[model samples]
Target chain A: MTLDTRTTVRARTATITLTGDVDAASASVLDEAIAAAAVSSPRRLVLDLNAVDYLSSAGLRCLVFAHQRLGRGVEIVLAGAHPDVAETVRLAGFDRVATIEDQVGG
Target chain B: MTAHRLVVDGLGAPSRLVAGFVSALAACAGLPPRQAYRLRLATDEITTNIAVHGYRDRGGPVDLRGRVEPEVVRVCIEDEAPPFDPTGHDPAPRVAAGPTAVLGGYGLFLALRSVDHFAYVHVGGRNRTTLCVLRCAAGG
Candidate 1:
């Protein structure tokens, strides 16, 4: 499966929409997108994971990397994660590092 | 029960194939959606570890075998690389507190937590790792 990432900036919040499986092969794609979004220096970074069907450890690592890179000033929110992905995040204890939401705006 | 073996190059591209293989096994074994997902997650993490860490810099063959029994789904991942015991490694910290918190090392942690039983053995100069997840469990 392929990973497609799109980042849009609105009112100091950069929302990244991701679709496809996030595994060892596709994690770099997400990392690069996160890096590009970080360059914008948004006040908040929101990741939309609703379309992500599979999230491997590599994907979780990328989220941690993003959390560290963005620093404490920028809030990181993982929005609309699939149940499986959300469970993995919870098991990995990543929910403490980033806010997880059932939906981006919900 | 007879185990089905699939040999693939220890590379990231083949992880998708492994996912499909395990998903089919989970369905045949009557695993619930959550349990099946956990099985898939464990399989993916282990295979990815072999591809990225076990066989790093030198590629080799990874043999994946699975069998669906009456009460459990067992999977064995065999690799002809240097012996690395996944079960021996310390799990990554559950919570990453600050910016300096390391990102890597979660692969093995997730792999171990998702399955009910995990074992590693080195025989005949091959590293064999077996993972078992309870079938039909209420919560995986």
Candidate 2:
């Protein structure tokens, strides 16, 4: 499937929803969203990964990049991650780095 | 004594599908959560590198070979792309406090820390990367 990325701002939060597979090929698209989100400097960043059936390490790099660039005080919430995808993130020790919701479709 | 193989191409979406599958396999084999995550992470980094930079945009297919033992799991990734050694890559630059420190550019660094063993080589005009993980004992 083709990759899709959409960003919306609610209050001081920015929600970026991703669909399709986020791998090396699609990381650039994510990079753009991350850059755009950085500009807003939202207090909270919510990554909606319900539609993201797949998340690669490259994808994880983007998330980490987001986490690093956002710095302290900014909260990154990952919502609606696929079972395997969520497990991948958790295994990467990302759960410790950010907030990971156990449930999907939020 | 069984070996599992997964073959993927650099087409449509990305190769994370391959990583997710391998991650599940590693978990089922009783690898620790952190270790499993690292395995998945390393697999993603090397495979994606081959897909993105290996074929010079003319990617073909990559072979993922997994051998899960009682005490350890071994992964051998073979690709016909460039002869890139993941181990030989330079360390990631430290991120300093300021706008100059970007968020990206730490893939190899993370991979290095995620696994206990790493070896890469160029063989038969393909990039072969081998990674191993030791099963952690309970409460250790």
Candidate 3:
């Protein structure tokens, strides 16, 4: 239920790594991490979801807000989502705004 | 015919526990991963809406009952939050193109779409949402 969020900015790219279940209680962590990433205005925002096991709609809504808050100029990429979680991303229409890749840093 | 029950005080963060309880029940019922996922999602979405929106910053209790029937697995979520049906239609964001699409009201919609059968009813100042997943012929 606890979501560990880490943000690293390098070479005009911001990578926010999340390691935990992303449910209603835990999604605020992701929201804050995305907020921190947006401050730097990175050209690319990569969310590393490889360690997350469950992603509820709350998390997806956070990503939608993050996408809007970061503006259209920033490229959003969701990296290393498990097949089930990836399917969730596709389920909420997140794939329309962000590139969901199976591999990170690829 | 395995049955499980969980009750959470939605005044605080209740979604994680509710979701975990459903997941464990699904495993106990021998539900397939896909069917289990859908039921969990539908249950989580409706209750979350109750806790977060219906009750707003303050709320009441939520009761969850999960049971495995002969042909399907079902979860009934009952909440004391103000009356509101989650099955109402919402125009979801268009996936075809444009970044203008918003995720608001999309949760309940996706929740309904994921489950095989869903029903919502308001009875005696309580809202109940039932979600069910059809078991495959081989018993998924």
Q: Which candidate is the best by lDDT?
A: 1
Tens-place lDDT per residue, model 3, A1-106, is 6899889999999999999988888888888889888899899999998898788888888877787889888889999998778888887667888999887787
Could you give candidate 2's per-residue lDDT for residues B35-102 as a string of tens digits? 67667767777676666677655767888889888787888989887577777763444422321244
Task: RMSD for all candidates, in order, please.
Answer: 1.9, 5.5, 2.4
lDDT of candidate 2? 0.73
Segments in model 3 whose C-alpha atoms lie over 4 Å from true places = B91-100, B137-140
Query: For residues B13-47, could you state the per-residue lDDT of candidate 1 as single tens digits?
Result: 56688888887787678788888888888888888
Candidate 1: stretches off by over 4 Å: B93-100
User: TM-score of the candidate numbered 1?
Assistant: 0.93
Instruction: Report iRMS (Å) of candidate 2.
Output: 5.9
Arranged by TM-score with the best first, the candidates are: 1, 3, 2
Q: Which CAPRI category fits model 3?
A: medium
Which residue pairs in candidate 2 have backbone atoms (N, alpha carbon, C) closer than 3 angstroms, thus clashing?
none
How well does model 1 score by local distance difference test? 0.84
- DockQ per candidate: 0.59, 0.26, 0.54
Residue A82 shift from truth in candidate 3, angstroms: 1.4
For candidate 3 chain B, which ten residues in a row score worst on lDDT?
A: B91-100
